[model samples]
Target: MNTKLKHLVRKIRKNSTAAENILWKELRNKRQGSTFRKQHSFPSYVVAFYCYEKRIIVEIDDQIRTPRSLYNHAREKQLTREGFIILRFTNVEICRDLESVMKKIREKL
Candidate 1:
């Protein structure tokens, strides 16, 4: 990653949302039986959480809109083509019932 991208990643990690922070606690430090990185930056995109060992990328969508939805679909297709399994959850799901979200991630694992 370039310096600008690295700085952007750091800024994101520093200003994470409540849901991201909650999920990060569970994904950090191999707590989920595998290593994961927060605000992981790829050459073209930055994902919420990524498990390189499993090629899994967890995305927390804060909102649903036409443009964002389209962008996410395209991004998902590209990432899937690269052999990644994308797991997306909403802020409500993360805060309302985190265990279910974790269960889904574990199932993927």
Candidate 2:
């Protein structure tokens, strides 16, 4: 990541959405048996959360179906091509049923 992207990542980390904050409580500090970085930047994308050791990227989408949108489809393809698994959960899902969300992430790890 370039300096600009690093700054952007920092900005994002400071101003996290409610859902991101809620999930971060569980994902931070090796709470899940692996370290996860929030607002992790790639060359062209800033992932919601990333686990470098497991090559996993967890994304929190605003819309429930945004994961299937064209842009996300292409992004997911590129990330998977790079051998990263992308897990997507919507804001509603995170706020409503965090246990299920954590369950899925645990399964991935």
Candidate 3:
């Protein structure tokens, strides 16, 4: 890994956001026999959550201040073209009811 990427991974490991921590606990140890990595580097992009075995990428959208629908749509399209399935959930959804989110992920898996 490049120095920047190594640093980013370290940061991800050491300073996971609340949602990332909660989700990582479930995703670690191959929860579905699928490995997950945080702050995964893609082509010129950094994904929040990635499962290579399942070809899935999960993005937790907080959207605290501005609308990101347009940009997210573009990113989703790019990932789809690259044979990745992208799943997005709002912070509210993740914080309030993660089981449903996990179920959605399993469905994709």
What clash count goes with each model?
A: 0, 0, 0
Order of all candidates by TM-score, from best down to worst? 1, 2, 3
Say which candidate scores most in TM-score. Answer: 1
Tens digits of per-residue lDDT for model 2, 6-108? 8988888888899999999999999999999988889988999999999999998885436578988888999999999999999999999999999999999
Residues 1-109 of candidate 3 have per-residue lDDT tens digits of: 6778777777766866678778878788898678998779875667789999889998877754133577677777888999999887776788889999999998988
- Tens digits of per-residue lDDT, candidate 1, 53-85, equal 999999998854233587889998999999999
Better of 1 and 2 by lDDT: 2
Model 3 spans > 4 angstroms off: 1-15, 64-69
Considering lDDT, where higher is better, how would the candidates rank from best to worst?
2, 1, 3
Worst 10 residues of 2 by lDDT: 60-69
TM-score of each: 0.92, 0.90, 0.81
For candidate 3, the 10 contiguous residues with the lowest summed lDDT are: 62-71
Question: Positional deviation of 29 in candidate 2, in angstroms?
Answer: 0.6
Once superposed on the true structure, which residue ranges of model 1 sit more than 4 Å away at CA? Answer: 64-68
lDDT of all the models against the reference?
Answer: 0.91, 0.92, 0.80
